[model samples]
Every structure is written in C-alpha cells, then in structure tokens.
Target: MDFFNILILAIVQGAAELLPVSSSAHVIVAEKLMGLDPTSPEMTMLLVMLHTGTMFAVIVYFWQAWRDTYFSSGHAFRSNARLIVVATAATGVVGLLLLKLIKHLVAGNDPGFEIEHLFANAKLMAAALAAAGVLIIASSRLPERANGALNLRTAAWVGAVQGLCLPFRGFSRSGATISTALALGSSRRRAEEFSFALAVVLTPAVIVKEAFRLYQSHALTVAKNGTSLLQLVGPSLVGMLLSFVAGLLALRWLSRWLEQGRWHFFGAYCLVAAVVVLLVG
Candidate 1:
C-alpha cells in the first residue's frame, strides 16, 4: 500500500473504531475498493497500528470521566472493578467459545483455516451489519430509564452480547454493548461511559492478537520482499498518527449524538451501509 491508501484506511479505521460501527467491516470494504489485500503483511501491520492509535484515543478522551466515575473513591473503585471483572469474564467466555466453534465447524479439517478468512465475506458482513443495526434501532426504542448504576446482571448481559460481536465482522462491539446496556435500563450516559471502559480494558488483548498475526505475516513477507521487519514501522506509525486524530473526532461525534438522543441515527446509517456493502460485494 502507498501513502494515499494508508492515509485513507487510517482515517476510516480511526473514525469507525469509535463510532459504534465496525471498523473491521468498513476497513475491509475500503481495502477491497482500494485493491489492497486485507490479509497482506503491510495492511495487517497498519491495522494493528491504527487500533493502537484508537485505543489511545479512547484513553485520552475518557481519562477525566473515568477518574470521576470509576476512581472517585474506594467504594466506587471496588464496585466498578467488580463490574468490569464480571463483564470481561463474560465476554471472554462467550467470545472464546464462539470463536472455537466457528473455527472447528467452518474450518472442518483444514488446519490452516482461520477466522481472518471470514473477514472478507460480503454476505456475512451484510448480515452481521443488519443484525447490529436492528439491535441498535430496537434497543434505542425501548422505554428509557434513569438507572445510572452498572450492576452485575447488566454487565453480564452486555458482555454476552459483546461476545457475539467477536466473530462477526460487521457486528459493532460498542454498538451492541451500549445498546444492550440501554435496553437493560442503564442511563445512556452511563452506558456510553461503561461501554468504552470495556473497550479500553479489552483492547490490549486484541492488539496482542493482531500483533501476532502481523508478525507471522512479516516472517513470510521478509523472505519474499527482502525487507526487514523494522521496515514496516514507518508506515504503521504514520497511519497510527492519522488514525489517532480521526479517532478523537469520532469519539466526540459519538458522544454528542448519543447524548442528544440521536443514537438510532447510526443504526439507520448502518442499514444503508449494509445495502451498499451487499451491492458492491
């Protein structure tokens, strides 16, 4: 990929990552349109860097709020810690089990078959996108409640839904978790805060996973292209910087729309995006 392609992909990754939309889905489509292979070493490395950039964005944007909410006092910190543990455990269980099942069933006897192989399936992406859109719309229409506390049951429910998003390319993690929390009667503001907190908590594992994939690809590409693994660093860093800027802006937009009671509009956009992906694919 050239500078221009990486820039476009980085912007898409940054914004979509925070906007209650699946950056993976959007980025994959963008890659296809740009004639870049998503599975290639350079592309995957750039993606890893993009995610790292966005992860930092999440931290920077939420630091003050998190301090006020999750770290205000000992009791508050303990309570939030319990909720995070429960939710993350639930997500881990669900995501791992589903991922294993998909690998076993979809791969059959093909040892080399991987979940990344499914990322480019437009039909699957469309279906998953539609599912996420429906969930977002339906949950937004539920009776609004004023509950501000995050309980164990609520965390479990949100985490379970998030697990479902793991293997599905177009299913948005933030969308599903935040919608599930809202549908469970959590306040919209609290839901948004907690959903992103979960994201911050879980991002490291995802980065490590992606890094491993990038490393494997690098080993192969280095032999063929006669370039050192370090050679990939410059482009990735540039992409990360671009994505970081875009991510900060996207977070602001998401927070504003969600607070203004316009969260469902993203669902509508997802519906249209689904159709577009289907048509183009």
Candidate 2:
C-alpha cells in the first residue's frame, strides 16, 4: 500500500475501532474503494497492524479503570474479578460455538472456510449493520440507571452479545455489547467500562489469531512492485501512533456523550452509513 492508503486505513481503523462503529466493515469498505484487494496476504497483515494500533489506544484509555477494578485488592475487586472471568468465559464459549456452527453450516458445504468469499454478499453485511444500528439506538433511548458496579447478570449478557458480534463483521462489537448491557439494566458508565475491559481481553486473541494465520501462509510477502513488510515499517509505525492518539480522543468524547444518553446519534450516523455503503460499496 502507498503512504496515502496506509494513512487512510490507519485513521479509519483508529476512529471506527473505538466508536460504536464496526472497524472491520469500514476498513473493508475503504480497501474496496481504494481498489485494494482485501484477500491479499499483505493486506491482511496491514489490517492486523491497524487493529494493534487501536488496541493500544483501548489499553491506554482504560488503564486507570482496569487498575482500580481488576488490579486493586479488596472485596469489591475480588467480586469484580470473578464476574469478569465468568463473563469472559461465557463470551469465549458462545463465540467459539457460533463460529463452529457457522463453519459447519456456511463453510462445511464448501472446501474453503474463506471469509473473503462471503465479502461479496453486501446484503448480509447491510443487515448486520442495520441490526447493530438499531440496537445502539435502542440502548441510547433507554434511560440511564443510577450508578452501580458490575453485576453477574449484566456481565453475562454483555459477554453473550459480544460473542454474537465475533463473526458478524458489520455488527459493531462495542455497540452490541454496550447496548446489551444497557438494555439489561446496567448503568451507562458501568456498561462502557465493562465493554472496554472485555475488549482488552478479547483483542489480543484476535491479533494473535490473525498473526498466526499470516505467518502460516507467509502472507506478508509483497510482489516486486508491491509494498514489502520492511518498506511498510515507517508508515505503519506512523499510522499506529496516529491511531493511538485518535483512539484516546474518541474514547474521551464518547464516554462523555454516553453519560448523557446521546448515543443514538451514532445509530443515526450508522443508518446513513449503511445507505452509503450499499450505494457506493
């Protein structure tokens, strides 16, 4: 990819990754619009790098909350830790099972479990985007409950929603999980906090999974004229840094807006975005 393309992907990945939008969907659309091949191994590596950039942002923004809740020692800490573990386990189980079902149902009939083949089917992504948009709007409409810490029921519900988001690229993971938390009676602050915390745990797994896939296939190889991994280092690092800054800014703004139950605006934006993606993509 060129420096301009790398920069574009980096900004898109940084902003959308933290916002209630689906970063994967946006990046895929951007790649398509740029006449870039999404199935390319080098493209895959670049995408993973973009995610890593935003992941750092997530960690930096949530470091305080994590340290206080998960790292501190107290009865409250123990309780929260147990709940987090339970919720994370439930998310993994549900996510894995759903992936299995999708493989058996969608890919079993085909020899390749290639997700890129499904990319041409924009209708599916459109529907998932619509669903995610609706859920976010609904969550925003709900009145914010009084401040309280995480609960087992709320955690489990959020985790399940996250699990559902795992395979569906257009379904915004943060949007779905946060909305589910709200709909299930979690306070906005608590929900957002838990949502981010879960992301911290889950993102590493995704990064590793994609990294292993890239390594196994020697997917980062570039053509003579194509951008090589070494060539990408400077731009990639620049992109990662930019993404980190953008992510921190986005997290701060979103958290403040969420406190006032203004999240429906994102839903409205997504509704419009869906239309644009359908028409242009």
Candidate 3:
C-alpha cells in the first residue's frame, strides 16, 4: 500500500471508529474505492492496527472519567470490574457461537474458509449498516428511566448486542452496545462510558487475533516478497500514529453530540451512508 492510501484509511478509521458509524464499513468502502482488497491478510492487519490506534485514543480521552467513576472507591471498582468481566464473557460466548454458526452455514466443509472472506460483500455490509442505523434511532427515542443505573442485566444486554456486531461488518459495535445500554434505561453518560470500556477490553483481543491471522495467511507472501514481519507491519505502525490523532478529535466530537441529545443524528448519517455504499459498492 502507498502512503497516501494508508493515510486516508487511517483518517477514516479514526473518525468513524469513535462515532456510532461503523468504521469497518467506511474503511472497507474506502478500500474498495481505492482498488484495495478488504479481505486480504495485509489489509485486515492494517485495519486491526488502525483499531489499536483508536483504542489508545479511547484510553487517553477517558482516563480521567474512568478514574473518577470506576476507581472512585474500592466497592465501586470491584463492582465495575465484575460488570466488565460479565459483559466480556457474554460477548465471547455469543460472538464465538455466531462465528461457528456462520462458518457452518457459509463454508460447510471448507476448513480453509475464514470470516474475513465475507468482509467485502457490499450487500451484506449495506444491510447491516441500515439495520444498525434503525436500532440506533429507535433506541435514542426510548424514554429515559429515572434512577437508571449500570447493572449486571444492562451490561449483559450491551455485551450481547456487541456480539451481534462481530460477524457483521457494518453493524457498529459501539453504536449497538451503547444503544442497547440506553434502551435498557442507562443514562447516556453511563452508556457512553461503559460502551467504550468494553471497547478497550475488546480491541486488544481483536488485535492479537488479527495479528495471528495475518502471520498465518501471509507467511508465503512475506517469503516470496523477501519481507520480514516487521517490514510488513511497519507501514501500519505509521498509520496507527496518524489514526491516534484523528481518533482523539473524533472522540471529542462524539462526546459533544452524545451529551447534547443529538445521538440520533449519527444514526441518520448511517442511514444515508448505507444508501451511498449500496450505490457505489
């Protein structure tokens, strides 16, 4: 990949990743437009690195808020920790089951087929984007419950919604999880915080998984091209740095819109984006 393409992808990933919009959808569309293969091992690795950049951005942006809330007291810390664990566990179970089911249905006896093979399907991506948009809009309209608090039930719900996002490229994980939290009666602030907290946990695992996949799939490519693993991933490192900066700006924008009761605007944008993707793709 060239520097210009990497830069463009970094910006797109950074911006959309933090917002309710599906970053994967935008990045994949951008890749297709640029004549890049979204399902390629190298591209998938770069995508994961781009996510790593935004994950750091989330940590930097939310550090103080997390400190004041999750770490406020010993009891608070423990309680929040348990909630995170439960949510993560739920996500793992549901995501794995969905992956298994998908592989069985789609690949059958093809042991070599991986989920990434479906990443470039435009129709699937568009439909998932539209679905996520509708969910976000509907959840935003739900009446807020007084004394809405983050509980085990709410966390599990959010996690399950997140799991639904795993197999579908255009189903925004943050959007689905945050909307689920809101619909379950949690405050916007709490939903935002918890959604990102789950992201921070989820991102590293994804990075590791993609890294392994890249190595497994691209070993022959690397040998043929006389490139080391470091050489292959070096460009992604630069893209990650650029994405980190963009992600910070995006996080601020998302926070402002979410706090100002304009959360549904993102959903509206997703709906429009879905149409555009279907046309262009």
Q: How close is every model to the real structure, measured as TM-score?
A: 0.97, 0.91, 0.95
Best by TM-score: 1
Q: Model 3: runs farther than 4 Å from truth?
A: 39-41, 145-147
Name the weakest run of 10 consecutive residues (lDDT summed) in model 2: 217-226
Tell me the tens digit of each residue's lDDT in model 2 across 127-243. Answer: 778889999998888777787556888788788888888888788898898889888888887888889888888888988987777665453354335555566456667777777
- Decide which is better by lDDT, 1 or 2: 1
Q: How accurate is candidate 2 locally (lDDT)?
A: 0.80
Candidate 3 lDDT over 1-281, as tens digits, reads 99999999999999999988999889888888899977566786787789899999999999999999999999999999999999999999999999989999999948888887887788999999999999999988888765688999989888888888999989999889989999989988889999999999999988898888788768877767765677658889988998999999999998898878888998998899999888987
In the order shown, what is each candidate's alpha-carbon RMSD?
Answer: 1.1, 2.3, 1.5
Query: How would you order the candidates by lDDT, starting with the best?
Result: 1, 3, 2
Model 1 lDDT per residue over 11-63, tens place: 99999999987888899889889988878788778888999999999999999
Q: Which TM-score value belongs to model 3?
A: 0.95
For model 1, the superposed segments whose C-alpha errors exceed 4 Å read none
Arrange candidates by TM-score, highest first: which order? 1, 3, 2
Tell me the deviation in Å of residue 203 in model 1. 1.1
RMSD (Cα, Å) of candidate 1? 1.1
Candidate lDDT (C-alpha), each: 0.90, 0.80, 0.89
